[model samples]
Target: MFLGMAVFLVGCAKGGSSLNTVPVKGRVTLDGAPLPGATVTFSPKTPEGRTAAGMTNENGEFVLTTIRAGDGAVPGEYGVAITKPVATAGPVDDPRARGGALTPEQMAQIREQAKTKGGAEGGSAIPKKYTSPTTSGLTATVKRGEKNEFTFDLKSQ
Candidate 1:
């Protein structure tokens, strides 16, 4: 009975090890400077599998991982999106802060207030296009058994 259990466990381990993944790492730079605290996402182009994502550290370095930490990503072409929101100076009121659905009038009032308060103050530092995978114009092909390292030079303008 012990032998059978051991064989089953080994089989399970082997099955788990069969998942295909490849290492992906990269650096992000905005206007020639390292961009920290930015989120980098890799959405598979062909629906081949799950998406892989990572956040840039202080040095603007990141490693793609999916399913498991640092396990890398499935080999395929992917659309990349990178974003970093600017910091706000003070707290802003949220329409749903009361813990219920907001009425249309309340939403309009908040929008008007935000416009008057300067909506761009706490907006994203990265270009709006770069925040969407479809519009970022960034693509990477993760090849199997190969080191997939990339450097993204983004422009704020």
Candidate 2:
């Protein structure tokens, strides 16, 4: 599970400046089981907020970031979308299949895919409706002062 977040922090987010982001973390579950490797996106309901995203670990836990790694998101209402693409054979496959330490070969493959597969397109294990914020039927409100933790329980049918 830690591996998934580590990869995302290294591959997706780069650090430099800061924003008025709060601490937002959450878990994603599909049909009562952890939905790992899924990308959890918080699409801003207003122009005042920016989009924030995080990748779920094997336990489906995630910490959101907007401007930098783990920086969280601006306080506002957001429509949520969760998507996990079908895996192609590689070291960077599904989190369930990827366990234990990473070999140098695995690291190499990860770096390459981090560059090439940034978009991460394919069919999803979950229903297609969960892939889009408009149709996800999920929404969250990130408050300003406290820890913003959420759990999304999605159904297959």
Candidate 3:
């Protein structure tokens, strides 16, 4: 009885946290122009694993990866957020240049600072609403056996 109970508990512990990811890719454009170097994120509407994200290349193309590079995300509906902050100021101190590796939290803070006070003397090319999943009005459904390609055409005005 004791061994059976132990096995049951172990099975329960390993039951639900498996990652079943699907490939997701997309393009982002603003005012008909490619928005390069933008950060695109997919936050699962229900409780999934960690969020998946990708950075757009120069052609404004991105591929989503959650656990491993290019490994993709779990199948689900996601709320999307995109942010691209173009710097308007001159050279500023970067933590990386000082040989200190910045944590994700620190990197996020830097991005926020740039959005609020960096671009063109504190201006942003992309609308602020697109920076948050709650406000971006972007959604995508990643299906199990479907090509999850999406396009987001944004307006600066």
Best by lDDT: 2
lDDT of candidate 3 over 7-98, digit per residue (tens): 99887655433577788889999999999877677777897444777777778988876655666678888878887665666644433333
- Each model's lDDT comes to 0.69, 0.72, 0.71
How high is the lDDT of residue 123 in model 2?
55
Query: What's the distance in Å from true for residue 79, model 1?
Result: 0.4
Candidate 3 minimal-lDDT segment of 10 residues:
111-120
What is the per-residue lDDT of model 2 for residues 1-157, given as tens digits with 9 covering 90 to 100? 9999899777644432334688899999999999988878888889767777777898989887665567788889998877776776564543324323334454343323332323246556787788767778899999999879999999999
Using TM-score, give the best candidate's number: 2
Q: Which is better, 1 or 3, measured by TM-score?
A: 3
What is the alpha-carbon lDDT for the whole of candidate 2? 0.72
Give the Cα-based TM-score of candidate 3 against the true structure: 0.69
Query: For candidate 1, lDDT tens digit of each residue in 1-157?
Result: 9999999988876541555878889999999999987767777788556567666777888876664555677889887878665767654343222223334454343333222322244777788777767778898999997879988999978
Report residue 154 deviation for candidate 1 (angstroms). Answer: 0.2
Q: After aligning candidate 3 to the native by TM-score, how far in Å is the CA of 47 from where it should be?
A: 1.5
Model 3 regions lying over 4 Å from their true place: 1-17, 88-123
TM-score of each: 0.68, 0.70, 0.69
